[model samples]
Target chain A: MFLVKIYVQLKKDILDAQGKATKKALESLGFEGVQDVRIGKEIRILLDGRDISEVSEKVRQMCDKLLINPVMEDYDFKIMEVEK
Target chain B: MKFGVVIFPGSSGEGDCFYVIKNIINKEVDYIWHKDLIKDIDTYDCIILPGGSSYGDYLRPGAIASKSPVMESIKEFAARGGLVLGICNGFQILLESGLLPGILLQNENIRFKCQYTQVRVENNKTPFTGQCSKGQVLKVAMAHGYGRYYAPEDVIKDLNKNGQIIFRYCDAQGEIEISANPNGSVENIAGISNKKGNVFGTMIHPERSSEEILNSSQGRVIFDSIIGYLKGVTVNGK
Candidate 1:
């Protein structure tokens, strides 16, 4: 078994509106000197695979097909072996 | 001509769209479930993906619904030059399906905006806008949280050059300005069409404002335009 952790975020050129709102709230709470804040999502998945490399390929396809919006978002994934 | 309204698991706009087509527009309409693969897609002259938080907007708005079986058939339908209209969440699905360019992000103010808004018709050549005069401002209602339309500079340029930009947020007097933008879309874009002009997606709910009793029958012009085009009305000699 393998556990995959994926992180998705808006592309660098795109504005993160939610992140900006959270930053404003943070500043209001006295967290000063913050340069910038960007927000994204993290998704975890478990899969049964024969090898890590094969699992990595499947995860990439999953991201491209469904997990991320290619027009505005980028994604990265990490896989680790786990006991069934 | 027949129309099909796709209903995703969490779709809430099908009833409104169905009503508008069956009652207001007086046409044949059917509800297509998300899981159903439409074999007779060619029979429908138009298909509508209406507004709502499909799949409860899991992961992202329209993300899951875009991958549903019905979307595949809709994609094929659009490829064949069948008119496709996507409103609000439907617009988001089109983007996610890659049937339309650009992406709809969270509103700049990070708030859900629901109000009657004005949009100017930028191009009347499309089948969806043939009944509207160029630069005519139509009053429509927009309700969504992620209504900000965004694209790369090159894509925006192409859209402008090709007249794919169908609608822009404008004031009542038909002046495009930042103040009239409800969700901070780039260049105040409220709606757009694909290069072929058969696929259109807009943030505004034309069906909601389609009745005189609603105080704005202007939205009916869009449907009328479609009906006219299907009936072989040559738009701008196109």
Candidate 2:
């Protein structure tokens, strides 16, 4: 079994509409001094397999294939092996 | 050119894309479902992703549809320099598919925005916007709740430098400067293209604005731009 943590974000060049809205909300909520904010997604993927490297590759593939938007998002992952 | 339009289960813009291409642009295109497997994925010259509430916006707009089977082929196709366009929820799909770059955050106002706004053309270099001159201001109808654009300063600057900033929300003057930047978007950007200028994405509904009865002459230019690009590429074989 393997555990993978995936983090997806909009590329630096891409805009983040959600974060700005949050910032606006925080400001409206009296959370002053909030200059700017950028929001992204973090996901944890767990898999059961022997070829952990293959799983890693698959995760990366997922990032580019469907997990992330190549246009507006970027994704990275960390892997850990589950052993008893 | 054999063009394919990706159709997910909830995509409502497929017909609009087809209608615009066939009637407005005078081009016939094929419909490609999200599950359809592409033999080569590289053979097609271009592809378009239509808009809709994929997965009924569950989890997120494109969280489910991005994982559809057609994405693999689209990725391969884009890697080989194939042209692709994602509009509205289609834009969200590109973000999920990693085709363009960026995340579609919820709108600043938290309400679904469906109105006609001005968009300024920032680039005329890509196959998507080659028909218009650089800095051309266009009136496009944007209908989305999460259409604000954001990116880091350096990246935004680089995008501006590389001419990847395709469309921007503009003011009454049709200038993509300050104060008129709706949605508080960074750089007033409304649409974008990849670094290679091949893949493109936008939140506005160009297909909706394509006809004169829609109250805008702007949509035709966008279609003309893409169609012109396709024709030019087809003729030049590049």
Candidate 3:
């Protein structure tokens, strides 16, 4: 078994209004030295596969097709083997 | 002229579009379900995608609905030079389906805004706005969370150069200003048209402004323009 963690976030060029709001809130709460903040989504998936490369390729296709909108967002995934 | 208004499961704007076209505009209109194939799409002079939370707006505002069966027919219709009008969520669908150039993102303030807005007509030559004079201002209702329009720099340049931009958010006097922009759309674009101008998409709900009760007949002009274009084509055999 493998556990996959995917993270999706708006591209750097795209303004992250939510992240900015959160950062402002953090600053108000006394957090300093914060230069930037970004908000992103993390999706976890479990797969029954032994071949790491094949599983990665499938995940990539899934991301490209549905999990991400390439126009405004970017995504990356990490896979780790897990005990059944 | 016949109008086909496509209704996805969660769409809320179909009824308004149908009501305005049939009762107000005095035109033949029908509701086209999303699941059904639009085999006779060519028979209709114009097809409308109205505003609503189609497919619960999952993934993206218009993402799931764009892949529906009827959209293929819409593509074919547009390719054959038929007019396609997308309002609000429909505009999002058009963007998702690649029928339009830009994508709509979350509003700049990250909040849903539903209110009356003023938009200036950028181009009057297109079929969708032929009835309006150049630079005319129309008062319309805009209600959406993801209404900010975004495109790459080059595409934005091309849109400006080609005069594909149909409307830009403006003040009551028809002056484009940031304060009047409900959403932080690039260049204050409130609406746009495809290169051929047959496919039109706008964030504003013109249908909502079509009746006397709405206090704005400006929206009726859009429908009038479409019907006028159809009549012209039939008469000219163009």
Q: Give the candidate number with the greatest TM-score.
A: 1
Rank all candidate structures by their DockQ, best first, as comma-separated numbers.
1, 3, 2
Off by over 4 Å in 3: A47-50, A82-84, B233-238
CAPRI rating of model 1: high
Error of 3 at B106 (Å): 0.9
- Candidate order by decreasing lDDT: 1, 3, 2
The 10 consecutive residues of candidate 3 chain B with the worst lDDT sum are B229-238
Query: Candidate 3 lDDT, tens digit per residue, B77-137?
Result: 9999999999999999999999999799989999999888999999988888888888999
Alpha carbon deviation, residue B137, candidate 2 (Å): 1.4
* Candidate 1 deviant stretches above 4 angstroms: B234-238
Provide the TM-score of chain B versus the true chain B for each model in turn. 0.98, 0.91, 0.97
Worst 10 residues of 2 chain A by lDDT: A64-73
Best by DockQ: 1
- Model 1: residue B220 alpha-carbon error in angstroms: 0.7
How accurate locally is residue B141 in candidate 2, as Cα lDDT from 0 to 100?
Answer: 79
Worst 10 residues of 3 chain A by lDDT: A62-71
List TM-score per model, in order.
Answer: 0.97, 0.74, 0.94
Instruction: List where candidate 2 sits over 4 angstroms from the true fold.
Output: A1-84, B40-43, B177-179, B233-238
| Candidate 2 lDDT tens digits, B50-152 | 8888888775688798888898888888888888889999888887766766667666556787788888777777787777766677777788877677655
